[model samples]
Target: MFRLAHISDVHLGPLPAVTYRDLASKRVVGYVNWQRNRRRHMVDALTDTLVADLKASEPGHIAVTGDLVNLALDGEIELARLWLETLGPPHDVSLVPGNHDAYVPGAFGKACRSWSAWMSGDGEEGPVSRDTFPYLRVRENIALIGVSTARATAPFMASGFFREGQAARLEKILEETAGRGLCRVVMIHHPPVRGAVSQHKRLFGVGRFQKAMRRCGAELILHGHSHLPSLYHLDGAGGKIPVVGVAAAGQAPGGSHPAAQYNLLDIDGGKGDWRIRLTRRGLTGTALPLADLEAVELSGKAAAFVRN
Candidate 1:
């Protein structure tokens, strides 16, 4: 069995000193929000503990679904790179960006340059950029596809975009990977399903995303932006595709949002008969140890899938 651990929205804390120039644009609003609200709930110590527990599980691979930084500051981006190293080497960890990573017009590009190693596809070399989306990485019988929905938005807006160009490319990748009999696992920063988040934070062009999936299909879908543990399904050509979201990895216990958590997926079997067991583990409270909260067994073919 291949054990894949999923974590997202670390939002590495202890905000690095920000210069006046750093907050010239949309970042000013983000900076104020972090200081007034975010810093209190998203703790670095909590994130550290969660990462330690995740490493102990010894999964075959790890998937990080973005929002690694709070303000997309240069310092924060560098700090996040160091944090990613602690999780695992680039080859063992795959990442996609979130809206906060692209908080400003040029911030996303900087993040892509710094975190390229963990986002590049197998055998992809040289400087990686924003255009390198829908990248493919093959591990054992699984095909991990990284899609980028992250984009810069106006102040107070936290939306993602799924353009037609990326959608077309994704469909091709899904079809090709499915033909290889590999379990296709698509990773995006935003939940593709509608109503996953509020209007200002929703994923725009979701119809294009759904259309692509319905044509080619995927074994499993993982996302992060909502910072809430959620499970939704999409109608795919083969069957129902499972789309899942997890809480922020740095969220403190007893926060307004769900506490920090990660999903451990055990994947076994082959193409048409794949079995995925999702085990969610995280902090229940400030005094308790990280523990398993729930488990659900999912099947590649939706008709035979079971939920509990």
Candidate 2:
């Protein structure tokens, strides 16, 4: 079985500690709010639990969907490498960059440079050549494609895109790799399809992404940037292709609530079927399955029965 684990929004490092310079400006209130409420929510603690639980699960592959850093700091990128190392090597682990990863000028570029120097692992730098779609790590019967949507934008905008360049390259990859019986797994930090949650947060090129994926056909897509559990199906890929969004593996700048969860995707290689199980990595280093969460499958696609 081609088992995989998916985690996202692991905003590692200590809780945000900030001092406001303006007393009456809204920024000051934001700083106070962060200190009072958000700073107390250390979702990164879930990473510890997740690492332990993942080791126990022993997934064949892992895909992380970005937001690895909190403030786009250089130190934060280093912290992301450390956190990713705890998961495993780059050959087994795959990742994409989120909006937060590119918040500052040339932040993504600098982080990429540093990660290549330190924790780029076995990650290939490109499938698009210009550094937008860095398709890497094709092993066994799977093609893991990672795209970069990280970009610096206005303070109010937190959107991502692959635009024409990356999207076209991805289409070519999918087409060239088709009928090879290779399970295609696309990874991005932003959701490529619109749904109920798209009301407030969404990827800028979601429609285009959908069009491309429909044209080329993908087995599954992994995403983050929305710190909630979401699963949906799209129209283009013959059968329903699943897109999943994982919860934060690190603390969020909100409260001390249980906003820490991730997904374990088990794909039976022989059967060509996949199932996703959601779990919450608790403080005591336990992976507890979220109650009532169901494993979804496309019509006529059966999951390998694993009797526990």
Candidate 3:
């Protein structure tokens, strides 16, 4: 089985000393929000502990969905580069950006530059940049596709959008990859399912995404934005496509949200005969290091099963 670990919204922090210039744009609002709430919930110490446990498990590949930096500050993105190092080399880890990574226009560019290695496509020869999307990375019997819905928005908005270009390209990628008989897993930072999240944080073109997958279906999808462990399905070429979401990897206990958590997907089989399973692991209580939250066999085709 190809073992993969999934985590998101680590929101790594210990905000660097910021000058007024850094907060001139939309960051001013984000800065205020960080001081008020984000700082409390997103704890780097907790993130380190959780990642330590994850590394001990030695997952074959790691998928960190997004929000590695809380404010997308210049310093934060740089820090994220170092954080990416602690995880492993680019080839071992796959990542996608989140709204915070694109908190502002320039910050998004910075993040792209800093994390390009983690997003480069398979056999990519050119200098990797943000312009490339629907990047394909083939691992064993699975084809991991990365999509970017990350974009800067006005204050109080955490929405994501998938343009027609990405939608069309993604459809083509899915169609071509499936012909090769690989289990396709699409990764984005936002939930692409309708009604999966609240209005302000919703993906604007979820229908366009669903439409693409409907025409050229995939085996699974992974996303992070809601800060909750969520599992949903969408009808695909042969059966239902599983869309899974994970809560923040750095969030501490004592809040409306759960403690730092992540998912382990055990995938085996090939093409139409794939057998996939999931294990949810996270901090169970204040003193608990890491505990298995749930485990179950996912439907090879359509039906269902999951714990928490």
Where does candidate 1 stray beyond 4 Å? 300-308
lDDT of 1 by residue, 165-205 (tens): 88888998898898899999999999999999999999998
What TM-score does candidate 3 get on C-alpha atoms?
Answer: 0.97
- State every prediction's TM-score relative to the real structure: 0.96, 0.80, 0.97
Work out how many backbone clashes candidate 2 has.
Answer: 7
lDDT, candidate 1, at 141: 93
lDDT of 2 by residue, 1-308 (tens): 66777878876767334444332233344344546655567544556766676667787887888877755666667777776777777667887788877766667786676554222324444322235454645667777878878886665456786788888888888776566667777888888777634544567788888888779877777888877667666655556677777767764434433456667766654324434443333232234532323455432333232221
Candidate 3 lDDT over residue span 1-308, tens digit each: 89989999988888999899888888899899889888898888888888888888888899889888878888899999999999889998999999999998877888888899998898886665556887999988889999999999998899999989999889889999999999888999999988888999999898999889888999889999989888888878777888888879988888778889998888899878888787888988786679888876765655456455
Worst lDDT 10-window in candidate 1? 299-308
Model 2, residue 265: displacement in angstroms?
1.1
Note the residue pairs that clash in candidate 3. none
Task: Name the runs in model 2 displaced over 4 angstroms.
Answer: 15-37, 117-132, 196-200, 251-258, 269-293, 298-308
Which candidate would rank higher by lDDT, 2 or 3?
3
